[model samples]
Target: MGKKKHEPPPPTGGLDQNGLEKRLCNCICLCQLVSILSGVALLYLSVIVVSPSKQTLDAEFESTPVVCTTLENMRNSTNCSVLSCGEWCISKGGSTCAIIHAKVRREGSAVSFRDCDPVRATFCSAQEYNQTQQFICSEGEDKTGQCDALDRFMDCKPIKNKADDIKTEMTSLCRNITAIRDCRGTKPDGTQEKEIHVCTRYTCNALNGIYECSTGNCKKLENPTCVDRCSNLDMGNMAVVTPDLFHWGRCRSAFSNGTRIWTDQQKPLSMYCTRIRNVSATEMEAEDCLNGTLMDAPSFRQITNYKQMLGVLERNEEPLFEDQSFLPSEKTVEIFNRTKVMINVLGCVNTLRKECTTWLAHKGRDGSEGMHPAVYPCFITPHATNYVITDYDRQATVSQLVMASAVPSCLLLFSCFCLCLCGKTVGVNEFGLFFCKPCHKQDGDGGKEPAKLRAP
Candidate 1:
């Protein structure tokens, strides 16, 4: 007989097609749940965890304390830090009071009382205690005699003559030589020591009886000889030197009734003028003018009656200098023009000593004609009138708008994509339950055959 063929083992725990389908359905549902949970976690990290961490960092930065050590640093510190340091200094009296006293001696009345607070008077009085130290450290000590001689030189006014300019030059040279000799101390061999002198420039207006000099290398005058008179004889009507465009010489024009009026040769005009008039008990109208039109208005006043209007000069009891004729020499005019062009090019408006706005109003029958606009409609408007958006505000608004729209939309799209990929379902019943029932197949011996699974 032939060897019996090995019979194939029957499949264990056989499942039908329906059971395979149910298993596949369960697997898909599990995968979908996992994907949804993963998406939610991603969203939490993106929106809640990461974003809140940045916010927390910003909050920490804002809450951080400002630290200042030295007095100079304390002075330049933030308001909160300054207050804290001041309080600390106040509590730590003795040494801090000495320090405050030193500062008061150096800065004089310019020192801020806020830093010393309740002890300002004590700090000020400390100067008396330290007077000997001030004298010991003074720059004026070694040069006292020379400075007095220089002061005498400044006082001596020679008789006005043809050789006066030459005499003045010699006097300046002698004073400068004396200043340099005095600033340098004598060595062991009687030779002058080579030490640098630190000099500060000050306007004549700032100078009082005694020249307040800072302690450094040594003290020296910028101009060794003071100006007893104007240097140039050509400076006619301009007795006082002024840093301005139309300074007692250069002509300025104004508009009246659609006509440009030039000032007299003796008196220079102002560029702009302001006039005020009473409209009611509670209200008044003001008008301002440039060379041509009223600055506040779009249209020019074609029909202005100067006679009917009472000028500000009449209301105020200020006297108008009617007898004076302010005629400047040709040299003075040239200097004024040159200085004006230079300052204008450099944009040094703050340095101008006499601006057109500073001109006083004068209305008289005779010689005060070109002083300032009298009955002219001139108004003083507020410097800044329009609303403006700053760079910081604009940037903040843009950032807020972008965050409001972009963040939510991005999260929503990510969630939808995750659901589409992992949670696709095909069959469902009327009761909203997923249909996946197992079905069995009969074999020739009345036994069930294993079901082959299909991918969903």
Candidate 2:
């Protein structure tokens, strides 16, 4: 019976093989579908899923670009500007990623960003400020905590009409003006440089070509509308005209040496030295008394701070005019005669008439002489009051005469106009108007030459 049962099982072996083949095919299809579904899930997550904390911010600025992985890092990054994180993404490998991007547009030497989270401000190069080099942006600090707290500061303020608020805003803006009072830069030499912020509209002045600090405003440095008489170098707030000063120095030297005489128009005429005194002996003594006496006597030499010296003159109590006398009265007489002769020779009669008529209209003859008013004796001009002749030469040499007459012909009218100005007492005749004289009365004869008339 056991032999017969085994024989029946052997007969069904072919069906068992067919059943095994069907099961193998179903397993391969299931594996393929599972692989495709896994890929689909990954792609879906890539498009929508993102981490909240991990972010990157990018800014294109003149200074430096910034990239940060989180908003907290962004706030700490020195190169970060006025921006915040907006969106983020997670990588397929489950890596968290964040990004922020911004661009700055400005044309200036330096630009500063305000309201930035981590990196607050950056400076740019300008024509004047930091002339030596441009500032570069660099890493600043670490901001780890307070990530959610910063969002509270991000709400945009509603725009409002600013015409009236502008006035108040101006005051509010300037409220911090004096708050940064200790902004002065220190030099290596232990001196402090003046501190001024050049970024403002109220203080800007076009008269200044560059930015400067006004009392409370930023002002522009102005170019000279008139001639530029000085350099950009600082003279401690008092500008010095070098060329003008140099010319004055030359004139002063010539004047003191008694070897040069210049016209009112700065024309060198003749070399003549005439002795000058300090008004009176007692005048010098009074000066000596007020200033507690001098180391030496007061001479014709120019004094430093003459205005201060004049103040001393006002308070002087001692007699300074006593015993004061003119040197060589005969020389004075000869000069007077020569002047009279020149008047007659030059035929200034008509000019004199016009000037006298004008003068009488302006200043009536109460005690003043009409045609020839005496202002310190030697001065003879229409507006010669308070004027004095500093020097006089008997005869000018030919060389001196040429130099005196060599001024540009174009300036003749300008010189005349300047003389007619209110503060000017010297007239055109002093610089012009040649005198023709009788042969005996000419400069070469009988006139005693002063020291100033000597050749240099």
- For this target, which candidate reaches the highest TM-score against the unseen true structure? 1
Mind giving the per-residue lDDT tens digits that candidate 1 earns over 142-259? 3331222222111111122222222222111111221111222334676543433332211111121212233322322332323211112221111111111111121123223334
Report the lDDT tens digits of candidate 2 across residue range 1-456: 133221111111222233333443344345445445544543443233211001100111112211111001122334322212211222121211211221111111111111112211111111121121111011112322111111100111112223331232211111111111113233566554344433222211111122223433332222312211111111110100110021011111112123221112322111111111222211110000111111122321232332223333333322222221211111222212211101111111222234423322322211111111111212232232211121122223223333333332223434434424412321112323222222122223245332232233
Give the total clashing residue pairs for model 1. Answer: 7
- TM-score against native, each model: 0.21, 0.15
Backbone clashes per model, in order?
Answer: 7, 26
**What's the lDDT for residue 72 in model 2?**
15
Off by over 4 Å in 1: 1-194, 197-223, 226-248, 252-267, 271-456
Judge candidate 1 against the unseen true structure and give its global Cα lDDT, from 0 to 1. 0.24
